[model samples]
Target: MNDQKFVDAVFFELFDENFCRYQDSLTKPTTGEQDSYGRARNALALLNSAQRLDVVEFLRVVIADTASVILGALDGVHFPDGLEGECVVSLDGVEIQGDLQDMFLSKAQNLGIYD
Candidate 1:
């Protein structure tokens, strides 16, 4: 909700897509997981100090969207009656942890956001 958070979010969004796009271009180690979100957040930690408002605006739009919902879902999910659970799903032959991705896709579908 804050400017830094907004910029961080945009950075994450872009980082995520770029990571996926160039995945095959990068070499992988057998021991570590990709810190994709961490990379983006680190890139914008001082966003409020920056002069540009574009990244902040982009983060606002993104977080106001299903992507944020997905992140929330990834972290945790609550039902209408207050039930909660972890969610995951298979999409395009890849297993997506539905906890966040599903929540994101569902909201995006409702909002008509898609690839």
Candidate 2:
């Protein structure tokens, strides 16, 4: 798939499946409520645990396609604990830098994944 198509697919999986539902679960009327950071973190965690090849591949593609916007969104965002160790994009068993995790979270937030 092309870059944009791959990015869209990954996002569709995020929003259409577990990510949106997970955000809903985290919401509490009494509390001030969480933001896209939690939603993105949990979603990435789930994707990482699944070890889906398509997701990893598309992530690489989208990194080139959308890095600037994602990077811009990264400012002041708090990464989830252990995020550096848990989620990743690897090619031939070689893990890319932890920046990919931040990229993923930023993309999700920019897309309004929690909404």
Candidate 3:
């Protein structure tokens, strides 16, 4: 996929899936969680208009930078010693395996976000 498409796919994977999960967890949400959920819903709504391009770009940068930090921290460590060979990470119960950005992209692709 092209760079823009890849970015959009990753963003959609991150945002939409988490949004759904958070919505599901609001059955007995605290006040803070309820407020946060409201803000998240509003953010999702903003994506429908032209004014959200900058917001989307900003979120992309934040996601990339956050991924870099997390992946960088995991670089070159012995799995058995540091990660205990149980380092499996999942999104929505789907296994995701990779070092950094690949992890997120792989999940995105697995979810057919690129399609």
Candidate 4:
């Protein structure tokens, strides 16, 4: 798949998996907290709709912006040449090794989050 499609797939997979875990962790919110939990559930439901592309796009932007800041902080670290094995990100059981900032920025640009 192309970089943008690949990144989008990875993003959605991660979001779906993590969001389910998050919902599980709540394990039935109390009466006072039900509204908040219900809202979250409704949001997820909306994301499943074809009409909610705008919501999905907005979420992608938010995720990319947040990830950029986190990954940008690693820019100052100097790794030895032989230490490449230590840096890897597993997406769909495949280990990808590269400069994460560059990878993320490229994908973000593909998403039109940056000019």
Candidates 1 and 3 compared by TM-score, better number: 3
Model 1 regions more than 4 Å off: 1-66, 75-83, 98-115
Kindly list the per-residue Cα lDDT of model 3 for residues 3-114, writing each as its tens digit. Answer: 3344455556656765345445432323443376666545555465454444444454455556545543444322433543434544556544344455555554565444
* TM-score, candidate number 4: 0.40
Model 2: per-residue Cα lDDT over 82-104, one tens digit each: 43423344444554433543555
Models, CA RMSD each: 15.9, 14.7, 10.3, 9.0
Question: What would the per-residue lDDT of candidate 4 be over residues 23-114, giving only the tens digit for each residue?
Answer: 46434333443466666545555454453444444555676666655444443234444443244455566544344556676766765764
Off by over 4 Å in 2: 1-12, 19-89
Quality of model 4 by C-alpha lDDT: 0.51
lDDT at 28, model 3 = 30
| C-alpha positional error of residue 26 in candidate 4 after TM-score superposition, expressed in Å | 16
lDDT of 1 by residue, 9-97 (tens): 44455445543343323222223334774454444444553422444334434544535554555445533345476655434545544
List per-prediction Cα lDDT, in the order shown.
0.44, 0.45, 0.48, 0.51
lDDT of 2: 0.45
Q: How far is candidate 4 from the true structure (C-alpha RMSD, Å)?
A: 9.0
- Among these predictions, the greatest lDDT belongs to 4
